[model samples]
Target: MPGFTKHMYLNDLNKIKSDFSNYIKNIIQILSEEYNLDSIMYILEKYYPYECQILNEKYDYYCLKDKKLIPLNKKVRYLMPKPKSIIRGLKITKKILSKTYKDNYALNFDKNLQLENEELLKKEREPKINKIKEKIDKAKLKAQEVEPSFLDELMGLYERKRTTQKDKVYIFKELEKYYCLKVISFF
Candidate 1:
Protein backbone atom coordinates (compact mmCIF):
# COMPACT_ATOMS: atom_id res chain seq x y z
CA MET A 1 0.00 0.00 0.00
CA PRO A 2 2.91 2.37 0.45
CA GLY A 3 3.70 2.71 -3.23
CA PHE A 4 0.45 1.51 -4.73
CA THR A 5 -2.13 4.18 -5.58
CA LYS A 6 -5.85 4.43 -4.83
CA HIS A 7 -6.57 4.87 -8.51
CA MET A 8 -7.68 1.87 -10.50
CA TYR A 9 -4.86 -0.06 -12.16
CA LEU A 10 -5.77 0.33 -15.79
CA ASN A 11 -2.53 -1.35 -16.77
CA ASP A 12 -1.29 2.06 -17.90
CA LEU A 13 2.43 2.74 -17.49
CA ASN A 14 2.65 6.05 -19.31
CA LYS A 15 1.40 8.26 -16.43
CA ILE A 16 3.53 6.74 -13.66
CA LYS A 17 6.37 6.15 -16.08
CA SER A 18 6.41 9.82 -17.00
CA ASP A 19 6.67 10.89 -13.34
CA PHE A 20 9.10 8.12 -12.40
CA SER A 21 11.32 8.90 -15.36
CA ASN A 22 11.02 12.56 -14.50
CA TYR A 23 12.19 11.79 -11.00
CA ILE A 24 15.29 10.05 -12.39
CA LYS A 25 15.89 12.90 -14.84
CA ASN A 26 15.50 15.49 -12.14
CA ILE A 27 17.96 13.60 -9.96
CA ILE A 28 20.42 13.50 -12.85
CA GLN A 29 20.00 17.21 -13.51
CA ILE A 30 20.47 18.12 -9.88
CA LEU A 31 23.51 15.90 -9.39
CA SER A 32 25.15 16.50 -12.76
CA GLU A 33 25.02 20.23 -12.18
CA GLU A 34 27.36 19.72 -9.25
CA TYR A 35 29.27 16.53 -10.12
CA ASN A 36 30.49 14.47 -13.03
CA LEU A 37 28.44 11.73 -14.68
CA ASP A 38 30.61 9.01 -13.13
CA SER A 39 29.70 10.12 -9.62
CA ILE A 40 26.08 10.46 -10.59
CA MET A 41 26.06 7.02 -12.13
CA TYR A 42 27.73 5.56 -9.06
CA ILE A 43 25.05 7.02 -6.82
CA LEU A 44 22.27 5.95 -9.15
CA GLU A 45 23.75 2.47 -9.34
CA LYS A 46 23.83 2.19 -5.57
CA TYR A 47 20.23 3.40 -5.37
CA TYR A 48 18.81 1.54 -8.35
CA PRO A 49 18.24 -1.74 -6.52
CA TYR A 50 16.21 -0.08 -3.80
CA GLU A 51 14.09 1.58 -6.48
CA CYS A 52 12.77 -1.79 -7.50
CA GLN A 53 12.01 -2.69 -3.89
CA ILE A 54 9.97 0.50 -3.48
CA LEU A 55 7.90 -0.39 -6.50
CA ASN A 56 6.67 -3.51 -4.71
CA GLU A 57 5.60 -2.08 -1.32
CA LYS A 58 7.71 0.52 0.42
CA TYR A 59 6.22 0.77 3.90
CA ASP A 60 3.63 -1.95 4.13
CA TYR A 61 3.53 -5.59 2.96
CA TYR A 62 6.85 -7.24 2.16
CA CYS A 63 8.00 -10.85 2.11
CA LEU A 64 9.77 -11.31 5.41
CA LYS A 65 11.42 -14.40 6.75
CA ASP A 66 13.75 -15.27 9.63
CA LYS A 67 13.55 -11.78 11.06
CA LYS A 68 14.84 -10.25 7.82
CA LEU A 69 13.10 -8.45 5.02
CA ILE A 70 13.02 -10.39 1.76
CA PRO A 71 13.04 -8.32 -1.37
CA LEU A 72 9.98 -9.14 -3.41
CA ASN A 73 10.72 -10.92 -6.66
CA LYS A 74 9.09 -10.10 -9.96
CA LYS A 75 6.79 -13.09 -9.44
CA VAL A 76 5.12 -11.80 -6.22
CA ARG A 77 5.44 -8.05 -6.92
CA TYR A 78 1.98 -7.82 -8.48
CA LEU A 79 0.40 -10.23 -6.00
CA MET A 80 0.44 -7.68 -3.18
CA PRO A 81 -2.01 -4.81 -2.75
CA LYS A 82 -1.14 -1.61 -4.58
CA PRO A 83 -0.22 1.61 -2.78
CA LYS A 84 -3.19 3.85 -1.96
CA SER A 85 -1.49 7.15 -2.72
CA ILE A 86 -0.62 8.78 -6.00
CA ILE A 87 2.16 10.79 -4.35
CA ARG A 88 4.02 7.62 -3.43
CA GLY A 89 6.60 8.03 -6.20
CA LEU A 90 7.61 11.50 -5.13
CA LYS A 91 7.61 10.58 -1.46
CA ILE A 92 9.71 7.50 -2.08
CA THR A 93 12.18 9.47 -4.20
CA LYS A 94 12.40 12.17 -1.57
CA LYS A 95 13.04 9.70 1.22
CA ILE A 96 15.56 7.78 -0.87
CA LEU A 97 17.54 10.85 -1.91
CA SER A 98 17.00 12.84 1.27
CA LYS A 99 20.20 11.50 2.79
CA THR A 100 22.28 12.34 -0.29
CA TYR A 101 20.53 15.66 -0.83
CA LYS A 102 22.84 18.60 -0.08
CA ASP A 103 20.16 20.84 1.43
CA ASN A 104 19.25 18.09 3.90
CA TYR A 105 22.81 18.36 5.25
CA ALA A 106 22.13 21.89 6.51
CA LEU A 107 18.56 21.15 7.60
CA ASN A 108 19.62 18.06 9.60
CA PHE A 109 16.56 16.43 8.12
CA ASP A 110 18.21 13.05 7.71
CA LYS A 111 17.54 11.51 11.10
CA ASN A 112 19.71 8.42 10.71
CA LEU A 113 22.67 10.37 9.37
CA GLN A 114 22.41 12.91 12.19
CA LEU A 115 22.62 10.24 14.87
CA GLU A 116 25.42 8.45 13.08
CA ASN A 117 27.39 11.64 12.49
CA GLU A 118 26.95 12.76 16.10
CA GLU A 119 28.31 9.46 17.35
CA LEU A 120 31.22 9.54 14.91
CA LEU A 121 32.05 13.13 15.92
CA LYS A 122 32.06 12.21 19.60
CA LYS A 123 34.43 9.35 18.93
CA GLU A 124 36.65 11.49 16.74
CA ARG A 125 36.77 14.33 19.30
CA GLU A 126 37.71 12.19 22.30
CA PRO A 127 41.48 12.24 21.75
CA LYS A 128 41.53 15.98 20.89
CA ILE A 129 39.46 16.68 24.00
CA ASN A 130 41.81 14.64 26.16
CA LYS A 131 44.78 16.51 24.72
CA ILE A 132 43.13 19.84 25.58
CA LYS A 133 42.38 18.69 29.11
CA GLU A 134 46.01 17.58 29.55
CA LYS A 135 47.21 20.97 28.32
CA ILE A 136 44.90 22.74 30.78
CA ASP A 137 46.12 20.55 33.62
CA LYS A 138 49.70 21.37 32.75
CA ALA A 139 48.94 25.09 32.73
CA LYS A 140 47.20 24.85 36.13
CA LEU A 141 50.21 23.05 37.60
CA LYS A 142 52.55 25.70 36.17
CA ALA A 143 50.41 28.53 37.64
CA GLN A 144 50.39 26.90 41.06
CA GLU A 145 54.18 26.58 41.08
CA VAL A 146 54.75 30.39 40.85
CA GLU A 147 57.22 31.81 43.45
CA PRO A 148 55.71 33.65 46.48
CA SER A 149 58.18 36.55 45.90
CA PHE A 150 56.31 37.40 42.68
CA LEU A 151 53.00 37.61 44.60
CA ASP A 152 54.52 40.13 47.03
CA GLU A 153 55.98 42.12 44.14
CA LEU A 154 52.52 42.08 42.41
CA MET A 155 50.84 43.35 45.61
CA GLY A 156 53.45 46.14 45.98
CA LEU A 157 52.82 47.30 42.40
CA TYR A 158 49.05 47.39 42.99
CA GLU A 159 49.38 49.13 46.37
CA ARG A 160 52.02 51.71 45.27
CA LYS A 161 50.44 52.88 42.04
CA ARG A 162 47.43 50.93 40.77
CA THR A 163 46.56 53.65 38.16
CA THR A 164 49.88 53.70 36.26
CA GLN A 165 50.06 51.90 32.89
CA LYS A 166 53.43 50.39 33.93
CA ASP A 167 51.84 49.17 37.18
CA LYS A 168 48.99 47.70 35.20
CA VAL A 169 51.45 45.84 32.94
CA TYR A 170 53.38 44.49 35.96
CA ILE A 171 50.17 43.54 37.79
CA PHE A 172 48.73 41.83 34.73
CA LYS A 173 51.95 39.86 34.10
CA GLU A 174 51.98 38.55 37.69
CA LEU A 175 48.25 37.72 37.43
CA GLU A 176 48.94 35.84 34.22
CA LYS A 177 51.88 33.98 35.77
CA TYR A 178 50.00 32.96 38.93
CA TYR A 179 46.44 32.62 37.65
CA CYS A 180 47.20 31.30 34.16
CA LEU A 181 45.38 34.16 32.41
CA LYS A 182 46.60 32.92 29.09
CA VAL A 183 46.48 35.96 26.79
CA ILE A 184 46.74 39.58 27.93
CA SER A 185 48.31 42.63 26.33
CA PHE A 186 48.24 46.32 27.30
CA PHE A 187 48.66 48.88 24.53
Candidate 2:
Protein backbone atom coordinates (compact mmCIF):
# COMPACT_ATOMS: atom_id res chain seq x y z
CA MET A 1 0.00 0.00 0.00
CA PRO A 2 3.04 2.30 0.26
CA GLY A 3 3.60 2.75 -3.48
CA PHE A 4 -0.17 3.17 -3.72
CA THR A 5 0.12 5.67 -0.84
CA LYS A 6 -2.47 7.95 -2.48
CA HIS A 7 -1.21 9.98 -5.45
CA MET A 8 0.64 7.11 -7.03
CA TYR A 9 -2.33 4.85 -6.29
CA LEU A 10 -4.51 7.03 -8.52
CA ASN A 11 -2.50 6.16 -11.64
CA ASP A 12 -4.37 2.87 -12.01
CA LEU A 13 -7.57 3.85 -10.21
CA ASN A 14 -9.72 2.21 -12.89
CA LYS A 15 -8.24 -1.17 -12.18
CA ILE A 16 -8.90 -0.69 -8.51
CA LYS A 17 -12.54 0.20 -9.18
CA SER A 18 -12.90 -2.87 -11.34
CA ASP A 19 -11.46 -4.95 -8.59
CA PHE A 20 -13.89 -3.39 -6.13
CA SER A 21 -16.74 -4.10 -8.48
CA ASN A 22 -15.78 -7.76 -8.68
CA TYR A 23 -15.48 -7.89 -4.96
CA ILE A 24 -18.98 -6.44 -4.56
CA LYS A 25 -20.32 -8.92 -7.08
CA ASN A 26 -18.82 -11.83 -5.18
CA ILE A 27 -20.19 -10.55 -1.89
CA ILE A 28 -23.65 -10.25 -3.38
CA GLN A 29 -23.49 -13.79 -4.71
CA ILE A 30 -22.82 -15.23 -1.30
CA LEU A 31 -25.91 -13.58 0.11
CA SER A 32 -28.17 -15.05 -2.59
CA GLU A 33 -31.72 -13.72 -2.75
CA GLU A 34 -31.43 -13.08 1.00
CA TYR A 35 -29.77 -9.69 0.55
CA ASN A 36 -31.54 -6.39 1.21
CA LEU A 37 -30.23 -2.86 1.44
CA ASP A 38 -31.28 -2.56 5.07
CA SER A 39 -29.59 -5.78 6.12
CA ILE A 40 -26.48 -4.95 4.11
CA MET A 41 -26.39 -1.55 5.81
CA TYR A 42 -26.64 -3.21 9.18
CA ILE A 43 -23.70 -5.43 8.42
CA LEU A 44 -21.65 -2.52 7.12
CA GLU A 45 -22.49 -0.55 10.25
CA LYS A 46 -21.45 -3.45 12.41
CA TYR A 47 -18.22 -3.86 10.49
CA TYR A 48 -16.59 -1.25 8.20
CA PRO A 49 -19.31 1.38 8.92
CA TYR A 50 -17.54 3.92 6.69
CA GLU A 51 -18.74 2.37 3.44
CA CYS A 52 -22.35 2.58 4.66
CA GLN A 53 -23.10 4.60 1.57
CA ILE A 54 -23.19 1.34 -0.32
CA LEU A 55 -26.24 0.29 1.66
CA ASN A 56 -27.89 3.70 1.58
CA GLU A 57 -27.66 3.86 -2.20
CA LYS A 58 -30.01 0.96 -2.82
CA TYR A 59 -30.62 2.17 -6.36
CA ASP A 60 -27.08 1.08 -7.21
CA TYR A 61 -28.04 -2.53 -6.64
CA TYR A 62 -31.58 -2.29 -8.00
CA CYS A 63 -30.42 -3.67 -11.29
CA LEU A 64 -27.75 -5.97 -9.87
CA LYS A 65 -27.00 -8.99 -12.02
CA ASP A 66 -25.80 -10.97 -9.03
CA LYS A 67 -28.33 -13.60 -7.95
CA LYS A 68 -27.83 -12.95 -4.26
CA LEU A 69 -29.20 -9.44 -4.39
CA ILE A 70 -32.18 -10.42 -6.49
CA PRO A 71 -35.50 -10.32 -4.64
CA LEU A 72 -37.71 -13.38 -4.06
CA ASN A 73 -41.31 -12.62 -3.15
CA LYS A 74 -40.17 -9.36 -1.51
CA LYS A 75 -37.90 -11.20 0.87
CA VAL A 76 -34.18 -11.75 1.41
CA ARG A 77 -33.25 -15.11 2.91
CA TYR A 78 -29.48 -15.59 3.22
CA LEU A 79 -26.75 -13.63 5.03
CA MET A 80 -23.01 -14.14 4.65
CA PRO A 81 -19.85 -12.89 6.34
CA LYS A 82 -17.55 -12.09 3.40
CA PRO A 83 -18.75 -8.52 2.89
CA LYS A 84 -18.54 -7.75 6.60
CA SER A 85 -15.03 -9.10 6.73
CA ILE A 86 -14.04 -7.14 3.65
CA ILE A 87 -15.49 -3.94 5.05
CA ARG A 88 -13.82 -4.51 8.40
CA GLY A 89 -10.47 -5.03 6.73
CA LEU A 90 -10.81 -1.79 4.76
CA LYS A 91 -12.09 0.15 7.80
CA ILE A 92 -8.97 -0.63 9.79
CA THR A 93 -6.76 0.53 6.96
CA LYS A 94 -8.85 3.64 6.25
CA LYS A 95 -8.89 4.75 9.93
CA ILE A 96 -5.11 4.50 10.26
CA LEU A 97 -4.65 6.72 7.16
CA SER A 98 -7.73 8.92 7.46
CA LYS A 99 -5.95 12.10 6.40
CA THR A 100 -4.26 10.32 3.53
CA TYR A 101 -7.17 8.00 2.70
CA LYS A 102 -8.17 10.20 -0.25
CA ASP A 103 -11.58 8.62 -0.97
CA ASN A 104 -11.58 10.79 -4.04
CA TYR A 105 -8.81 8.60 -5.33
CA ALA A 106 -11.25 5.73 -5.53
CA LEU A 107 -13.97 8.00 -6.97
CA ASN A 108 -11.63 9.32 -9.63
CA PHE A 109 -10.55 5.79 -10.39
CA ASP A 110 -14.15 4.65 -10.88
CA LYS A 111 -14.83 7.63 -13.17
CA ASN A 112 -11.83 6.94 -15.34
CA LEU A 113 -12.64 3.25 -15.55
CA GLN A 114 -16.23 4.03 -16.61
CA LEU A 115 -14.95 6.39 -19.30
CA GLU A 116 -12.56 3.78 -20.58
CA ASN A 117 -15.28 1.15 -20.63
CA GLU A 118 -17.54 3.55 -22.54
CA GLU A 119 -14.80 4.11 -25.11
CA LEU A 120 -14.52 0.38 -25.55
CA LEU A 121 -18.28 0.09 -25.98
CA LYS A 122 -18.24 2.88 -28.53
CA LYS A 123 -15.63 1.01 -30.52
CA GLU A 124 -17.74 -2.13 -30.41
CA ARG A 125 -20.70 -0.11 -31.74
CA GLU A 126 -18.73 1.34 -34.68
CA PRO A 127 -20.33 -1.01 -37.22
CA LYS A 128 -23.78 0.54 -36.71
CA ILE A 129 -22.47 3.66 -38.44
CA ASN A 130 -22.92 2.05 -41.86
CA LYS A 131 -26.45 0.92 -40.99
CA ILE A 132 -27.41 4.48 -40.10
CA LYS A 133 -25.99 5.82 -43.37
CA GLU A 134 -27.93 3.26 -45.38
CA LYS A 135 -31.16 4.28 -43.64
CA ILE A 136 -30.57 7.93 -44.49
CA ASP A 137 -30.02 7.12 -48.16
CA LYS A 138 -33.21 5.06 -48.32
CA ALA A 139 -35.20 7.91 -46.76
CA LYS A 140 -33.91 10.40 -49.30
CA LEU A 141 -34.95 8.18 -52.21
CA LYS A 142 -38.44 7.65 -50.74
CA ALA A 143 -38.96 11.39 -50.30
CA GLN A 144 -38.03 12.10 -53.91
CA GLU A 145 -40.49 9.46 -55.20
CA VAL A 146 -43.33 10.74 -52.95
CA GLU A 147 -43.79 13.91 -55.04
CA PRO A 148 -43.06 13.55 -58.78
CA SER A 149 -42.81 16.92 -60.63
CA PHE A 150 -44.74 15.69 -63.72
CA LEU A 151 -47.96 15.51 -61.65
CA ASP A 152 -47.96 19.32 -61.31
CA GLU A 153 -47.75 19.89 -65.09
CA LEU A 154 -50.60 17.42 -65.70
CA MET A 155 -52.74 19.11 -63.03
CA GLY A 156 -52.26 22.54 -64.69
CA LEU A 157 -53.37 21.24 -68.10
CA TYR A 158 -56.51 19.61 -66.61
CA GLU A 159 -57.48 22.83 -64.78
CA ARG A 160 -57.21 24.91 -68.01
CA LYS A 161 -59.33 22.40 -69.98
CA ARG A 162 -62.12 22.42 -67.42
CA THR A 163 -62.42 26.24 -67.25
CA THR A 164 -62.01 27.11 -71.01
CA GLN A 165 -63.87 24.15 -72.62
CA LYS A 166 -67.16 25.37 -71.08
CA ASP A 167 -67.15 28.53 -73.34
CA LYS A 168 -66.01 26.66 -76.49
CA VAL A 169 -67.74 26.12 -79.95
CA TYR A 170 -70.31 23.60 -78.61
CA ILE A 171 -71.98 26.39 -76.61
CA PHE A 172 -72.22 28.67 -79.76
CA LYS A 173 -74.51 26.14 -81.48
CA GLU A 174 -77.04 26.33 -78.63
CA LEU A 175 -76.99 30.16 -78.70
CA GLU A 176 -77.80 30.19 -82.51
CA LYS A 177 -80.92 28.02 -81.92
CA TYR A 178 -82.19 30.40 -79.19
CA TYR A 179 -81.84 33.43 -81.56
CA CYS A 180 -83.80 31.67 -84.37
CA LEU A 181 -86.66 30.83 -81.98
CA LYS A 182 -86.83 34.46 -80.80
CA VAL A 183 -87.14 35.76 -84.48
CA ILE A 184 -89.97 33.29 -85.30
CA SER A 185 -92.00 34.43 -82.25
CA PHE A 186 -91.66 38.16 -83.35
CA PHE A 187 -92.98 37.38 -86.92
Candidate 2 residue lDDT tens string, 54-129: 4333223322323444555434322222433434445332342244433433333454555565465445434555
Judge candidate 2 against the unseen true structure and give its global Cα lDDT, from 0 to 1. Answer: 0.39
Stretch of 10 with least lDDT, candidate 1:
58-67
Estimated TM-score for each candidate: 0.27, 0.20
Where is model 2 poorest over a 10-residue stretch in terms of lDDT? 178-187
Predicted structure 2: clash tally: 4
lDDT of each: 0.46, 0.39
**Alpha-carbon runs more than 4 Å astray in model 2:** 1-109, 142-187
